[model samples]
Target chain A: MRSSAADRTRPTPLDGLVVLAVLAAAAAIFYFFRPVSGNFLTARIVLDNELVAELPLSDLTEPVTLEVPGVRYPITVEGENGRVRVLHSDCPSQDCVHTGWVSRSGGQIVCLPNRLVITVTGGAAEADAVTG
Target chain B: MTHSVRRLTRCAVLTALALAISVCEGLVPLSVLIPLPGLRLGLANLVTVYALCRLSGRDALGILVSRCLLGAVVGGNLTALAFSLSGGLLALGTMWLLLRVPGLSLFGVCIAGAAAHNTGQILAAMGVLASPAIAIYLAPLLAASVLTGAVTGAASILLVRRVPFDEGKP
Candidate 1:
């Protein structure tokens, strides 16, 4: 007598428990390494994978446009109310524009085609990568 | 139909369905719906799960590879082909291994596969970007994988139960 594939694949209670345990463990790890809020308040800009400028969000009184060498368009960096953002860019994907603002450490605005990245430093945000 | 011919036809039909789902998924703006980059419902995995449960591992592997190739071409992102291929293969391989566990259900297997897919993609991203910082995404990606994996697994279970497929001897 042979068992059908359906029977072989039937899930037992233990299977559910195991999956639940794995998920819980993942959540725990996320919570443990979660970004912490701190006083680090500078946005570091990198162009062509090189550190170009570091703007202190605390001292920003008005919006400033940054021009990168060899890039046709400039990136408008604005700081307001303890937050920073890329107000404008000439990149095709507009990913930088879509990034909106970075107020916490670990927040980043990456323009892949332009090879530009803006990341907040000296805060509790410690995430080094973004995933979907 | 003769057993050999019937097997071939089944594999073709499953491959076509998988490809269609993959392409259709590309058309939908899953990012808008989920508000996350590189995240999708992974609806195409439904077909893979179904194949794994009902068909031979070889047949499922064929369908998975074909679907990934055709999907990447049709979607017009050749650069993404590497990521998709690595992720899909990792997921399929994980599910295959987990299925051998006696008490493990399809749901758990699928969830594991989903998680593996994310890991594989992240690894690929690290290589492409030439940066190891991408590892920080592991926790979030795992969390997301749990959700997406559960949804896909549940759907696959429903499909396997509801749809009648001839379970011939392997």
Candidate 2:
């Protein structure tokens, strides 16, 4: 029937209010940074922190498989219109494969073990260079 | 039981419980269910909070380190050990500081700790990847932390209210 010191220090509603404020701020940040549709016509593939390939999504007449050195499996990048995706990968987690099509600026899919990253970039000159 | 022996027993029992919770939570595949990488309920943290409030800070830290090391070993992931250790230590430090604040309760302390944990893990990821773009994951991680931290914090508060852990007080 004895109460501990922890029990004596009761949490006020202010504690809940503070947590709610934090959650709201985090949600707001996430909303503002959410992927947006833009001139994202190219997908840049970086392997081992180096730029491996930059494929124009608009010009893909057929899918292309890129086998970067030092990685266990090849990555198949497929695109149509303005969207791109990793159709296949040999990475164990398959997180990149699960990411599916990314058609907007700021979208990214990372294969950590393979040190591979696929990201969409939006720019007129870069898109033109890749498409041309 | 004698006083010192009783304290040791309590620490052992709490450490084992925390480890069990950590290992069991690892098996749930929360990431697959939620489709979010590095997301977890952090159920074992309840024990850490309980210890921090009821027992000594040293006891809480001991339980936390034991849980992280044993959990990683049982989960069979050496890479995860780095992340967990960095995050766990950061969270523990943050909780220790926040618990001293005047108006803040365990709920606030836990929420801050969770946020700190996420930040530390992201920093570790950035280091391992050699890229700062991983910071983009922070918002989502923070949002997830709010939910999971609240659950664990509230649970700990309820537990501390009901359970008499004063016997092990140092």
Candidate 3:
């Protein structure tokens, strides 16, 4: 009986409108910002804001593996067939290892624990900042 | 109980309850359920949601802040304070604003707040990790937040309606 009078506390008609607005915004951002796949073959590895290694995926006759000394443990980076991934890492979060793979331009596999970032691209584009 | 004392006690209880929920959430591997990155049920948020709907914004903000801090300390993960603090404040700010709009309720307020929470976390992460590439996670995280927001919003509405603690308050 108490809630019956407090309709303001319940779902309103505008709920649909707001939900649709945010979902539409999410879809637009996802679609427009989606990464581009194919042809961009350089996998640049950066550690601690410094450029570390640049592997040309297109020129690889075989899968190339890099064993980088991370902050606490060694990290393995693998690249081949225009794709790159963190093959292994002992970082507590394992966020970098779980990143799986990157085969597209603007795609990145970052290991924050190791201050490592790997970006694949045909030409390097400066990272763009987005404000909330 | 005097009104001020009662309100203060209620805020403290809400803070403890919210902190416990948040700590438990951190231990649970929710990935098994949602199989998505950066997605959580955000159950603790329901406490703040209920607070805002029933109590004044001041109490709600107090609960949110103390809960995040205690939740981090209890979880023994101070690194989390950055993300949770940013997300919690933004979520509270969004919810507080949305609650004032005519015809809007917990559902819509929480949905927008959840999105804002994710945005705040990403923004903080970009600062912490010093990498703009982290922005790639924003879209996916926001998309995942909608589902979480809906679930939390439902729980929040139930809490707000069933609590019946502050029926006489404005």
Candidate 4:
């Protein structure tokens, strides 16, 4: 069998389409599930359904320490004018730190070891804070 | 019976190669490039791609199944089995899909397969944790997937060039 250019290879347009489709689906999922509010100051830390910590992060200057059973993580709040983030953590995975800054609605930092989560709600903090 | 035996032997050799690469990757600490956790070279995927193109789908699946089971035993990380399972299935499935295209090279197919594998693994993590937030990390994982996919795919391409897949009858 004589090998020819056709036998060797060609560009796969369908493969590119597949990659684009997956990317689009991912973006759609992200957009659909995106939090409604755009305010980053409504960040809250919750364990189970009870509110552990709530911050209006517009004036976040101090680092906060959140401790659960067998785990202690310090959430360092930095940045000014509503662009704050959890700078550091003591978790084994360090996933929370890699989560970068949470400025958008529906963004959160979770430490599975302690079953702890820091959520950034897009909406303004209600006068009466509701626990989820 | 002779044909079956030859296929099994080939599968066994490929499995050994995959396992060796996986073990070698595990032994070394590779945090210098980026500090992202659960990062691996996934060199084993070269064998998976080779089997998918040269052998039957069943043969490719067999390689993956055997590799996953024995790989977990040797690596001693049952937790990793979940990620590998999801990733392998997705990777193989994508490769099979691309195989339908008449002129697609094994290298392109493998690259596509690797990307799908990473996506599947990340999705599995999110599902297991009941946290959709993990989706945010997909960008970095996709970037890594492209790089590793190209490296492994190119290597697999060169390998197929050297060892033609037309010899064995499955």
RMSD (Å) of each candidate, 1 decimal: 7.7, 7.0, 8.4, 7.4
TM-score top scorer: 3
Best by lDDT: 3
Docking verdict class for candidate 3: acceptable
How much is A98 displaced in model 1, in angstroms? 18
Model 3, residue B9: distance off in Å is 0.8
Please give, for residues B67-154, the per-residue lDDT of candidate 1 as tens digits.
8888777888876888888888898898877777667666677778888887778778878865555655666767777788778877
TM-score of model 4 vs. true structure: 0.68
Q: Each prediction's Cα lDDT score?
A: 0.73, 0.75, 0.77, 0.66
| Colliding pairs, model 4 | A37-A122
lDDT of 4 by residue, A43-120 (tens): 677766567666665444554433333335544533334444657666678777766666655667776655667776
lDDT of 1 by residue, A1-132 (tens): 111323434556755775776677568756665554555467778888777777766555666555555654666766654567888888788878877767766778888878888888766443232111
**Backbone clashes in model 3:** 0
Between candidates 3 and 4, the one scoring higher on DockQ is 3
How are the candidates ranked when ordered by TM-score, highest leading?
Answer: 3, 2, 4, 1
Candidate 4 at A112: error in angstroms? 18
State which candidate, 2 or 3, has the greater lDDT.
3
TM-score against native, each model? 0.66, 0.69, 0.72, 0.68
Off by over 4 Å in 4: A1-40, A44-54, A65-104, A107-119, A123-132, B28-31, B165-170
Q: Weakest 10 consecutive residues, lDDT, candidate 2 chain A?
A: A1-10
Ten residues in a row with the worst lDDT in model 1 chain A?
Answer: A123-132
Q: After superposition, how far is residue A120 of candidate 2 from its true place, in Å?
A: 7.1
